[model samples]
Target: MGKLDLVMFEEEFTQLQEIIGRLQVDSSSKVVFLVDKNGQQIAASGDLRSIDATSLASLTAGNVAATDGLAKLIGEKEFSLLFHEGEKDNLHISIVGKRGILVVLFDHNSSLALVRLRVKKASRELQEIFEMVEKRAQSQSGESSKFESPFSEITDEDIDKLFGD
Candidate 1:
């Protein structure tokens, strides 16, 4: 919210993308992604070939926001992660930055401790990347105002025209 002076380095973003991809391979996980706070997919890897990372990213953020809110109400600080293990599907979600979230999907063979350990290291790297992204966004905001709103500019008519009945 404050003036973002630190820019997200492209090199770091690329490094993070690679890091997640490597983790997927090393841990035998099926999916991994880096998402912005608004739910936009920043980077991804693994068996998410068909899944939509953008939507997942947003849902992950919602999960973090809910937990963070709860923590505040309980007089606790924001924790790094939340894990959900079901009969079949398992999910590990973590906050990477103020405006970033990481979601990992795996099977029963993967241990929560391993995921937590990997995430701790990943989170440290992501925090650095996000600081840079914030700075870049702040610097670019001045020039970005000239463009029309990407979402607002598209209307129902445009959608219907693109895929008409």
Candidate 2:
């Protein structure tokens, strides 16, 4: 019930990168990425430049939200995983730590079973990291009010300069 501020420290970010790296190899996935529930991309590995990551992250979050709603309507608590098979490519999405999502893109080279297996392991690790982040955030809550937000330093002229005529 406390304020949840998700902050990614350097160590946590490195662990996330490592998790995705291992997943790509173990699952033989074409791409692996993690996105927060709010549609913010956290980390990625493999052939990421080949896809529109921004759009994909946003859509994946939306997909998870929609599926969760459907599950509630059906009297289920939630649907944690989703898979979509394509003619040449496939997608596997898994909910992680209640605040993040793991997405895997694969082709004929990898089977859903393998992706699912690897994702399960990765999700466990990711969940732990997310918990740690939450704990850290909670511990720092007392000091958070004293800290100035980075955005607070940006002047209106700074934003206008980025799109000046």
Candidate 3:
């Protein structure tokens, strides 16, 4: 729940929100949300003002992680998307590269086919955006100096106890 002050988060968030605006849906249930892989909301649009975007983001991440873990248990690499259809609502999920998940919530009136198509198209663009951020991260990491003895005196047993393993 720490503040999302990470570099490039704002730029990426703004770009994706614009793409979400292109879909066009009802105001009540049609909301587009972007959450990190760890389930932090980077940006959102539509009728999410009352919603806790951060909690929703975290839950979405857990759902994706659970699905991916289940896939691995069954001998699959990873999952890219998940779609759920209910009587009055539908959920569309897309994995945004290695960094995050895009979750769209809408009802029966919204065209599933169109949503899928748009999500697929946007996923690639999101991937490219994330790659640039990663390159920046690598570049920044390269610029920093690694500490040699910040915690060198801490014993393994003490660390294990701290971790409570």
- The best candidate in terms of TM-score: 2
Best by lDDT: 2
Error of 3 at 75 (Å): 0.7
User: Residue-wise lDDT of candidate 2 within 1-165, one digit each (tens)?
Assistant: 655768887999999999989999999999999999989899999997779999999999999999999999999998999999999999999999979999999999999999999999999998999999888777777687765667768988898999993
Q: Give the TM-score of candidate 1.
A: 0.73
Name model 1 segments beyond 4 Å from true. 1-12, 138-165
- After aligning candidate 1 to the native by TM-score, how far in Å is the CA of 24 from where it should be? 1.5
Per residue, candidate 1 scores C-alpha lDDT tens digits across 5-108 of 33345687688788888777766678888877666778888977778776788788777888889999999888677889988768888877687788888887
Better of 1 and 3 by TM-score: 3
* Candidate 3: RMSD to truth: 7.5
Candidate 2, residue 93: the lDDT equals: 93
What is the TM-score (0 to 1) of candidate 2?
0.89
**TM-scores vs. true structure, each candidate:** 0.73, 0.89, 0.75
**Clash count for each candidate, listed in order shown:** 7, 0, 0
